[model samples]
Structure formats: C-alpha cells, structure tokens
Target: MFDWRWDFVAEIMPRLLWATGNTLMAAGIGYVIALVLGLFLALGQRGSNRVLTTILREGIEFIRSTPLILQIFFVFYVGPQFGLVLSPWVAGMIAIGLHYSCYLSEVYRGGIESVPRGQWEAATALNMTRWQTYKQVIIPQSLPFALAGMGNYLVGIFKDTPMLSVIGVYELVHTANAIGSENYRFLEPYTLVGFIFLAISLPTAALVRLFEGRVRSKMGMN
Candidate 1:
C-alpha cells in the first residue's frame, strides 16, 4: 500500500536518535567500568597470594564460560529478589562490564607477559617499586599490545548494546520496535535500525583496523 506516511519518519527520527544517544552513553559508561575493573582483575590474578590468584582465576573462568544474556538476566532479576533492585539499564551496564572485564583481564595479562623479561629486570635493577614499574615502565610499553584488544572490545560493546533492548533500555533496536508496533509497518523501522547499526559498527571496525595497523607499525611487527 502507498499509504505509508512520510511525515511519520520525520517524527520518529528524533526519538530514535535520542535512544541511540542513551545507548552510546551506556556503552561508554560500561566500557569505563570494564577498563578499570579489568585492570583490577588482571592485577588480582597475578599478584601475591596463591589462594587469591586461584579464586580470581576461577572467577574469570566462570564468567567467561557463562552466557552474557543469562548473566544480564541474573543481575537484573535475581538481585531484586535479594532486596537489591537495580534498574534495567544499570543492571545491563554492570553485567556487560563484569562480563567483558574477565575477557579484558586475559588481554591485559597476555600483553604484560608479552613484554620482554629484560624489561622487568631493568625495572628491578633500577630499584623501581612494583607500582612504579607498572606505572612507568610496563604499562606504557604494553599499551600498544593491549590497545587493539581494547578497541576491539569497545566495538564489541557497541554491537552488544542492542541486546540491552531486551531489558527495556530503549536503544536503537528498542526504538525501532516501538515504532513498528505503533505503525504496523515493520519494514522501514527495521531497515533503518539495521542501517544505523551498520553505520556505527562498520566505522568502529575500520577505526580498529587503523589502530591495529598503527600498533603493528610502532612495534615493527608489520
């Protein structure tokens, strides 16, 4: 039918963009949490006590082995049963951050270990404390190795933001669904949603590739 209202597209566009903004904010916050928490997980898994490291390793394994969707559900629904009520958006962000933190910890650990043993020796020879060694010597050198993985996960988080719609987060996909339900026209809304997702993800992937090239070049690995 040629009865589709063109003006409706104009009206929905603003709301869709607004929802997209929310999704972006959620992703940004979630990634920050993942970055900080991932560092802690990496540190915890590596430093000092054998029992602590074992627990941290097992926790990482458990999180990595489970489905993120189930984890989201558990954080959102199960927590409420215990008198800790987190909003869907909050729970979704927390779940995503926690899930990705485990993965990022491995990336960090690999990056750190990949650094030359001589570098560690040099830091020790300089009488640098552990904190100073990591702060000044290790982290700076290991960043390029970790950067590619971090960028990959940032794009990954953007892609996964759509899944937050299931928890009433009102992301792009959620906006599209609402539009479709109201208009009984699935084609336009769904197509637009797909296009928006592609617009975001494709550029992010391209940027990641660019970053990877730079990192490789800097390391002379290219």
Candidate 2:
C-alpha cells in the first residue's frame, strides 16, 4: 500500500526548499552564538577564582547532561513565567546555542591544552600579559586544533535544527509535516526531506574536512 508520486514531489518542492533556507538560517545563527560563548566558557573554567570556576563547571555539566528539547521547553515555556518572554525563534536559538556552548567549551579546552607548555613559557618570558598571551599566541595555535571539532559541531547543529519544529519553527521538517497533513500523503514530502538532508549534509561534511585541512596547513600544523 505504498506509492511514490513525482507529481507531488514537484508540487511541493518550492515550499520544501523555502523551509530548507529557514533551517540553514537557524543553524547559522545558533552556531555563531556557540562559537563566541563557548570560548568564554572554556576560559572561565581556567580562572583563578575557585568558587567561580566550580560553579561554571557545574553549570556547564548540567546543561550538557540534560536533553536539548527540555532546555528548549524550559526557555520557551518556563521563561514567560519569569518575565523572560521570547519568540519561538529566539527561544530555540538560545536553547540550541547554550546547549552547544557547553559541548564546545570542552572541545575548546582540549584544543587549548594541546598547545605546548613551552609556548606559555615563551609568552611569559616576553612579559606578555595573560590577555595578550591568549589573544596573540595561544588562540592562534589552538584554533587549528579546535577547527575539526568546530566543524563537527557546525554539521551537528545543522542536523539538530529539526528539533526546532517541536517549538513551532517553520523549518524543513515542520514544513514537510504541514505539507503531508494537507495532502494526506507523507511518502513524497518526507522522502524528499531525507534526500535533501543527504544532499546538504554530504557536501557540508566534505567542506568541513577540506576547510580543516586548509586551516591546519595555514597554521603550519600539517
């Protein structure tokens, strides 16, 4: 009792493609937030203030342990009760970004630790302040190490964008579901979505690997 219809695929292609754009946009926004905030989180864990470091570490661990959907619901549903009302888009982005920031902080910490101890000693010998040492030397060297992990998460966030549908985001899956409900046919739309994801994810993953190689080479990390 299964049938595939090319006509239905064509009829729905435009709307599906439009929703795909929204999906990409959501991923991009969330990724940028994670990139910036994750660095700060990684650094906070290394600070001299023991209490602050412990609290920050615990908070990051808590976020990492919980489900992202729970975080999304908490931000969207619970925040309104606390006078932190936000739109679905805002709530989704904040939740996704914050969730990934914790994961990325671990990645960043690993990258930072990969740098040679001598590098820090050399910076200290030059009388560089902590900020200057991190900004000028450590960050540049650590970035290549982090690049692979960063690329992985970039693809990860893209894949996870579908979770936004639970919060009413009009992303690809959400649109596909709507189209299927309207036509009473899920076969075509859902199949198209799978192929679309395959088409996008394959190339994106390849590009990330390619970009990582280039960054490594440019940093003389090859």
Tens digit per residue, CA lDDT, model 2, 1-222: 377888888899999999999999999999999999999999999889999999989999999999998999889999889888899999999999999999899999999999999999999999999999999999889999998899899989999899899989999999999998999999988888999999998899999999999988887875
Error of 1 at 131 (Å): 0.9
Candidate 2 lDDT trough over 10 residues, lowest sum: 1-10
Index of the highest-lDDT prediction: 2
Candidate 2: pairs in clash: none
Pairing residues by index, what is the TM-score of model 1? 0.92
Model 1: per-residue Cα lDDT over 21-118, one tens digit each: 98888889889999999999998887999999999999999999998888888889998799999998899999999998998998899888888999
The Cα error of candidate 1 at residue 14, in Å, is 1.3
Q: Please give the range of 10 consecutive residues that has the lowest summed lDDT in model 1.
A: 1-10
Give all TM-scores, in the order shown.
0.92, 0.96
Q: Cα RMSD to native, each candidate?
A: 2.0, 1.3
| Native-to-model Cα distance after best TM-score fit, residue 174 in candidate 1, in Å | 1.7
